[model samples]
Target: MHKPVLTIFYQFNPWYSTIGGIQTLINTFIKYAPNEFEVRLVGTGSDRTQKVGKWQEAELAGREISFFPLFTLENDNFRSLIPTTLKYAAALVGHSFASDFMHFHRLEPSLAALNWQGEKTLFIHNDIQTQIKAAGDKNAILWRRFPAAYFALESLLVRQFSQVFSCNTDSAQLYRQRYPSMGDRVKYIKNSFDNEIFYPLSRTEREAQRHELAKRLGLSEETRFILFAGRLHPQKDPILLVRAIAALNEPHTHLLIAGDGELAADIRTEIAQLGLSNRVTMLGALPIEDLAQLHRISNVFVLSSAYEGLPLVVLEALASGTPVVTTRCGETPKLLATDNGVVCEVRSPECLADSLQQIILHPENYPSTSCVRAAQPYAARTVMRDVYSGMFTRWEKRTLSIAS
Candidate 1:
C-alpha cells in the first residue's frame, strides 16, 4: 500500500539561526511524526548563500525532506517581502509534486494553497495583527500603510484553508471568534516538549548541576538565579526584563540570559549602565542540553515577551521543575491556570520586578513537584502525534473517495 503524501508549507531554517516558537513546533513535528505517511516540508532556507529558487534535500531520522528555499534576502524585515511572497507562492503552485493534503504553517505561505484541489490545513502560530502591533513603531507603520495586503494575507487566507490548528487556547479563541462559520474546523493542539530531553532531576543531581552552574558564573550557593532563554528582540521585550533586573537591585539576585540577537549590545550596555555587570551574565545562545541544564538549576524562568502563541521554553522550564514568571501573553494564563507559575503585566518593569520578588522571597509557595506535574500532560508525544495522524488519515480517505 502506498503511503499518503502530506506537504507542509512555511518558512523554515534548519540552522536554528532564525528561531521562534513556530519554528520550534515545526521542528518537533518533523522530528517525531511516525512513518505511516510521506512528508514533504516546503520552505525557504535560512542560509543566505543559497541561490533563489534552489531546491535542497536532506534525510532526518531516516525520513527524507525536500527543502525549497526562496531567493536570498539581505535581512528578515517582512516589510520588503511582497515580491518574495509572490515568488514563493508561484514556486509552490508550479511544483509538480502531488499531495493529498497541504499543511500551511503561516498565513503568508497559505497563498500557495489557494485553489488547490487537495485538502489544506492552517496552523495558527500567532495572531498576525497582535504581532504587527507588538512590533515597534516603524515596523507597525508598514502594516498600517498596507492594511489591505495584511488583511488579504491574514484574514482571507485563514478562511481559505479547510482545517486550522491553534497551538493554544488563546489562539483557538481568537480564530473561533474571528471566523465563526469555520468554528468546527478550528482545533486546539497544545505545543509539547520531549520527555526524553526535558524532565525533573533528582535532588542530588539538581544540586550538583546548580553547583557547577554557580561556579561557572562565579555565583554563591545562596544566589538566586533567574533565567531568560529566548531571542533578544524588541517584541520579546528583553530590555524591559533588563530594566526589571535593575529595579530589583538585590545583590543576591542574579540574571542568566541564554540567547542572542540584534539587541545584544543594547542589553550589555544597559547592564553595565545599571552597574549590574557582576549580577547579570549573558550566556549568548546556548546548546539545547546546556539550556535544559540551566533550566534545571535556575530558581525561576522568566519570559517578558509582548505576545506569544504558546512558548515551548515555558513548558521545558516547568518540565525541569522550575517555576516560570511570564507576562500575560498568549496561552500563558491557561497554561499557568493551575498555579504552576506567576503572570504579571506586560511592558511594566515595576510589576515584573515585584512578581519576581514575590517568588524569590517565598520560594516554598511554588513547589517544584507542582511545576513538573503541570507540564506532564504536554510532555508526552502520543496525543500530538495522534492528532496529526488522524488528520492525515481522514484527508487520505477523502481523497480516495473523490477518486472512486
Candidate 2:
C-alpha cells in the first residue's frame, strides 16, 4: 500500500532545531509521525544568499523528512515578513495540490490559503486574542492594536481548516464556543515531553549534577536553582521573572534562565538595575539535553507568562521532577492539581516571588515523585500515537467516502 504524504507548515526556518513551543511541537510530529505516512515540512528560512524556493531532505530519528523553504530573507523584521507572507501563501497553494493532508501550526501563515479547498488541519498554539489582550501595549505586533478585526480575520482563516487542535484545554474550549458549528472538529491535544531525556535523576545523581552546575556557574554547592526556560518575549514576561527573583531576595536562591528572544536586553537591564547580576544566569537557547539537565538540577521551575498554550517546558520540568511556580496561564492549574507545583496570578512579581519562595522553603509539599507522576499523561510516544491514530482514521474515512 502507498503511504499518504502529510505536509506540515509553520513560519520559521525548519533547519533550526528549536524555536519555541510551536516549533518543538512540529519537531515532535516529525519524530513520532506514524511510520505509514511520509512527512514534508514547509517553512521560511533566513539566509540572504540562498534562493527563495528550495527543497532539502534530511533524516531525523531514522525517518527521512523532506523540507521546502518558502522564501529566504535577510532578517525577520516586519518589512521582510510582508513578502515572506505572500511567498508562503503561494507556496502553500502549490504544495496543497501534492499533499494528501496538510497541517498548519499557526494561522497567520495560512491566512492567504483561505480559498484553497483542501484537507487542512490547524494547531492553535495560543488564544491569539487573549494573548494580545494580556500582552497589552507591550506587544509590537500590528494585530495587537486591532484585536477585534484581527480575531475576525483569524476566525475566517480558521474556517479553512477541516480540523483544529489546541494544545491548551482552555483554548480548545474557547475555540469550541466560538465555532459551535465545528463541534468535535476542535480537539484539546496536550503537548508532550520526552520521557527518556527528561526523567528524574536519582538523589545521588541529582546532587552530584547540582554540585557540578554550582561549581561551573561559580555558586555554592548549596545554591538552590530556580529555572525559567522559554523565549524571552513580552508574552513570557522575562523582566517580571527578574523582578520576582529580586523580590525573592534569598542569597542562596539563584535564577537560571535557559532561552533567549527580543526581550533579552530588557531582562538583562532589569537584572542589573535590581542588582541581581550575580544571582541570575542567562543560558541562551540550550539544546534539549542541556535544558533537561537544567531541569534536573534546579530546585524549582518558574514561568511568568502573560499567556500560553500548555508550555512544553512545564511538562519537561515536571517530568524531570522539578517543582514549578508559574503564573495562571494555559493548563498549568490542571497540571498542578496533583500538588506537583503552584500556580499564581499573572503579571504579579510579588505573587510569583511568594509562590517561588513557598516552593523553595517548603520543598516537602511538592514531592519529586508527584511531579513525575503528573507528567506521565504527556509522554511523547503515548500522546503522539493517539493523536496520529485519530487523524489517520478520520482521513481514511474521508478517502473511502470519496471513492464511493
Candidate 3:
C-alpha cells in the first residue's frame, strides 16, 4: 500500500481571492484528492514579505500548502526574473523528496523542475506562437514582443516533460510539431466547472434574492447587468469588455465587473473617456461565493480575453444556467460545446456589443441549461482519476522493467 507522492507546482496566491479558473481547477483538486495520496502544492508569490527560497508549510482542506518566496522586476521592455528563478530552482534541486509524479501548473516552474530527470507532467495551458499565428491586429504583435522570453522558456520545458496537457489541440499540435521525436506525449484536456456549486436556483428565489441584493446595493431595477470576471491583465482584454458595455449603454443595460488586476485603473479611465461611468461598475475582487451569486443574477457572462488556455469561467457560467457571450479567444470553443452562448471576435468591442445586444434583446429565446451536463468529464477529481489510472499503469511497467 505504498501510495506515490504527487508534488504539484503552480503560481498563485492559493487564497480565495485569486479569481482565475486555473486556480479554481488546482484548488478543487486539492480539496478532493483521495486519502491515500499525499498532495503537496508549492507556489511562489502572494504578499511582498517573503523573499526567495523562504517557504512555509500550511494545511488547506487537509492538503499540504507550501508557500515560497518569489520576486520579479517587470517593465515594458523586459522582465528581470533570473535571480528569483535560479533561487527557486536551487531550492527545488536541494530538496530530495521522493515524488513518484510531479505536476506543474505553469510553464516556468515546470521548466525549472525539468532540469532534473524524473517522471513529470506539464500543462502547456496556451501557445503564444499559435496565438500570434491566430492574431489579426496590433495587440497580438505586442504579445509577440512581451512574451518572447516566456515562449523560449516554454519550449525548453516541453522538451523535458514525459506527458503534456494542452488546453486546446491546435496549440498542442503546434508545440509537438517542434519536437518530432516526442510523439503522443501531448494531449488535450479541456477545462471543467463545478456544476454542484454553479447551477440554476429556483426562479422565485433567484428573483427575490436578486431584487433584495440590488436594493441593498442601491442598484436600479433597469440595470440589466452583464458580467466579465478575471484579472485585469492584457490577456483578459478587460478594456474590450468595457468598450463593449459602453457601446451598448442605452440607459437599460449595465456592466458590473467583479475582479482585480494590474490594469484596474486604466480600464476605469477607458470607461470614463468613453462616457460609460454611469453604465459600468467595477466591484474589484470578491470572494468566489460572492462571484457565484453575481453570476446567478447576471443576464449573461462575457469573457473579453485576447487569449486563454481553456476559459473555465465560461463553463462555470454555463453550468449556472446563465448563457454566455464571449470572444472566440483561446479554447473557448473547446470549453463550450453547447449552443448555450455566443462567440465574437477577440478585442472587437463592436462584435462583443452586437452579440450582447442580441442576447439582451432576445433573452427569453435562450435556454437556461444547455450542454452543461456534458462538462462532467472535466471535473478535477474526474480528470485526476483518468490521469492516475494512466500514470500508475505506466509506472508499474517501468518499475517491473527495471526489476526484470
Q: Using alpha carbons, what is the TM-score of model 3?
A: 0.85
lDDT of 1 by residue, 23-91 (tens): 566666777767776677776665666555765666754567766665454434233435454556666
Ranking by TM-score: 2, 1, 3
Best candidate, TM-score: 2
Candidate 3: global Cα-lDDT? 0.68
Q: Estimate each model's TM-score.
A: 0.88, 0.92, 0.85
Off by over 4 Å in 3: 45-57, 62-98, 131-143, 146-155, 334-338, 399-404
The best candidate in terms of lDDT: 2
Candidate 3 C-alpha lDDT tens digits along 1-404: 47656677655556536657777877776666665566666665555554545656766656765555343222211112333334445555655433677877655555445455558887766666756655434343344555777667666767778888888778788767877778688888766566556767666776777677667667776567788888776677788788777677455677888888667888888988998876778898787778888878787888887777777787777666677887876777655543567778545778889888877887765566563554556655667666667777776787788789
Error of 3 at 149 (Å): 5.8
- 347-398: candidate 2 lDDT, tens digit per residue: 6778889999888888888889999999999999999899788777877887
lDDT of each: 0.75, 0.79, 0.68
Report RMSD (Å) for each prediction in the order shown: 3.1, 2.6, 4.0
Worst 10 residues of 1 by lDDT: 72-81
